[model samples]
Target: MRLGRVFSVIAVCFFVSACSWFGGDEKRLPDIPEQQLYDEAITALEQQEYETAVEKLQMLEARYPFGRYSEQAQLELIFAYHKNFEPEAARAAADRFIRLHPSHENIDYAYYLKGLTAFEQDQSMFQRFLPIDIDQRDPGAARSSFESFSTLINRYPDSSYAPDAQKRMLFLKNRLASYEVHVANYYMKRGAYIAAANRGRYVVENLKETPATPDALAVMYQAYELLGEQQLAQSARDVLLANYPNYPLKSYKVKNTSLLETATFGLFGSESEADDPPRPTTEDKQGLEKPENEAQKEQETKRPWYHKATFGIFE
Candidate 1:
């Protein structure tokens, strides 16, 4: 009888524990109404609760895909993603909105936000306050940002965001030009004269009116000279002098030291090492007179809009 009582007590304890576990999970809050959910999301955004806002916005979209607040919710969702530092998601959302509502009145804003998202993606916390050269880094994000801004400006010239977009495009252009110059410099250091010259030529042909143009021309001149192409070098030099008369040119010389010797810090040297080679001298080259043809003059006079807008001030 005692044995039967013990088994019954154990069975009752197991049943009670199972009931408590299942009972707790059975109680759940009712689903919020669609309007209430959107309101809560907006409130969360206003209160700087970005994660909460994202959750609420997502729930609203899923619950009421055809509701009146659906369109506005999608737009707000893009902003919430941006604030939460999800640039890729923000860009995707913006693209989706644009595709779905091509004729939407606020389409320009979507384009602007897409560009802004790309612009902020590559910028790190250290870059904000540091005197860092953004151009020296990867140009992928900058290029994407530039294209997005260009699209906005071209599609909606009178957009409220056009001016800001124009400014950012100029900055990206200069950054891309600077990046080309950096690559050319690296090629020059490695003695890849042809590759360096090609990079310099690319800059001259594509990135006109930027600060890095003069340096690019110099690189082309040096690289061509190293490759024994006197005519090409002179052409590059003439263009540099014509555009920037005051820019200085540094003489280029081929180092005679072997790679092993250079790596070993000149440990293996000839008896005549004490005598330094004569440094090459640079002569000033005069620039040709400007062309008087109207077409040529117009081409030369064409400048970026930001140049005129900012009166030569750059960010």
Candidate 2:
């Protein structure tokens, strides 16, 4: 009985080995002709099969590196990667194309694609509908996108993509300026008055004319006030008031709270609670508070020069 069982086990093992030898893996599709592969990739792209298009384009590039369709295939690969949501691959392909054919007629397209890829990469799905402020997030990708678009604009001013690139650059500039303000705000919240003031000053000096400029000035004013730099605070406030008359600076003052009130968490404080009703200020009494027309004017002034020049077409 033991001998019969061992023979059966041996037979089962041999059958398993035979099955593995014959049915290892499915065969790969035969290599398609370069022209056929390119056509297929285009067809897949039209069909919105981005993954298949990327695969076919990559294969076409590998199989026909120097073929007649090579240059076109390389360019298509960047778009394919982008459509497939592979931003890093798209950027790499674009860079490669630009490096390989710097004087190519389609070089501007590569630059535009690089910039677009960077722009898309920086955009989060949450930003589409959420009220999230992009300034609070990392600005690395935004900076890169801005640089890429700037390069495209400077190098190919007359290119078809230049107009769009210029528009994106304006947005990126404002975004970066806002990011600086966000950092300054963070420092202010942490009581790092000097650092906050420096960041705010940086935005005012380096990112002039951006929508965040007024906010940057406000931050600088508040930070300097907290740091006891009354002169600097006054300077910032003057600039902010001059440029943005409707900017609300009434809330920038530091509240005076006694140590006893601080230690007691305001329960036994002499000062009124923050939520309690308060008397109107001098501006309110003088009818110099923010008016609806002033708010509208603020919005109008905040529009970038391009937006004004384009008559809100780009906005």
Candidate 3:
């Protein structure tokens, strides 16, 4: 009986294996010609079918890793990923291409795309239409973008992308400077006057000619004055008065973010944390038969009309 049971188990395993083999064969994609795959990917890109383009490009690379169009496919894959709003994938593809083909004639193009990806990494789809303060978001992506552009310019000064990269670098520098002043303002509101002063000094000393210079000098003046350093305060004040006498700069204020913002990064949360939470399960029975449950589906919660239209980005 034990031998019979063992044989029965082996027969069952063999049947399962045969079924899986047939299933795999049925689901396998057709093997298209190398040139045909690359052309389809290119056609999808031209039609702005980014998802389809990404699918074809990815499949081409997987199936023809060393084909005639392999390098070009890899390069276009980065662009496809970028157009599909897959910044992380685009960055990784760009990095891989750069590493594998350091001497490629189009290496500067790879660096340019890497910088472009990082340039918009911090911005969500909602930010395209919403006038949010990007400087208050994060500076890491901005710095990364700047470094990529800088490297491209330094390594390939004569490359056609250098001029555009120079423009982007200037914008990044100003954005970074503005971000520093924003942080300095935050420190001022927290009463960390010394730290605020240091940040202001960094902007003024390291990032010159930026639009935020006046704000930085103002922060330094206020921070030093608050710290009882009259000499340092006067020096900062002197520079401000000398350079931007007409600019009306004031201390920046701290804002209390809405509690609902945690879900959408401060774009949708309008209610404060002080508001009452959902009722307890024990105290929820208020109806004649059964009270409506307070813990309902998050998607069922009522939101503003604008939020509903723009929630896709947050999602």
Candidate 4:
């Protein structure tokens, strides 16, 4: 009986091996029609299902690299990658499309999208929700964005996207200028006068027409003054005064912030001199007081209960 069972097992093993070696009829998945695949991707895009759209578009490209809709698919893939939060992939796709179809009618749009990808790369979820200083962040992406927009405008001056590209380029230019001013401000607080002055000079010379020009001038003046370069300091100060009359030197910050104050989001204390709220003028106080009687005026002038208890901190 044992011998018979061993023989049956051996026969079963051989049958399995034979089936694996010589295949029976196996069903194949039908190739999706090119038009159908493109339509599905477009539908997903219209529905704002960018992840699905990206998958479909990728599949379409892999299956139909030279199909009628290949070029349009490539363009839509760039947008889909951007919408799906794949900035690097979006930029790669944009560059590839631009290289492949240099004379394409929509080449300008490709450049525009490429610039926009880098333009928004620094804006994170925290920046969207918190009160973060955008100018204090990295400026590499901003510079790249500016260059891409510049290329688009220079190469395709009459393209339909040139107007919006121009606007974005201006925004990037100002942003880059402000970033330089912020760095210079930091260097000033660190007592690195030469570095601060260099950054300020850069903004003044190359990044004109920006709101930060006044701040840059202020930094340069302060830095030169601290370094005992009286002539250079006066030159910077004169230009600042000529352009922005009545500017307060005390309004600029060149001080260090305590760790506790910085960690508490300036709730413990603030280092910024420019952020002080305007004090109420004497005329403004008198306008609020009624002339009913001396007692009534005195009562009105009294602080609120919580304000007095907290020594005016709560108020």
TM-score leader: 1
lDDT of 4 by residue, 1-315 (tens): 999999999999998788757763344446899999999999999999999999999989999999999999999999999999999999999999999999999989999999999988866788899999899889887898899899999999998889998998889889999999999988887778899999999999998989999999999998888888999999999999999997786534455667766766655544233333345466776655545685564653454545544666886
Residue 102: error of model 4 in Å? 2.2
| Model 4, runs deviating above 4 Å | 1-29, 250-315
Which portions of model 3 miss their true places by more than 4 Å? 1-17, 20-22, 248-315
In the range 112-161, model 2's lDDT, one tens digit per residue, is 89889889888978998799878789988888888889898888899999
Alpha-carbon local distance difference test for all models: 0.86, 0.86, 0.87, 0.87
For model 3, residues 148-202, the per-residue Cα lDDT tens digits are: 9999999999999999999988999999999999999889988899999999999
TM-score, candidate number 3: 0.70
Clashes of each: 0, 0, 2, 0
Tens digit of per-residue lDDT, candidate 1, span 277-301? 3343544232233335744646434
Q: Against the true structure, what is each candidate's TM-score?
A: 0.74, 0.69, 0.70, 0.68
Could you tell me which residue pairs clash in candidate 4?
none
- What is the Cα-based TM-score of model 4? 0.68
Candidate 2 residues lying further than 4 Å off, grouped into runs, are 1-29, 251-315
| Model 4 error, position 212 (Å) | 0.8
Candidate 1, lDDT over the whole model: 0.86
- After TM-score superposition, what is the CA distance of residue 113 in candidate 3 from its true location, in Å? 1.0
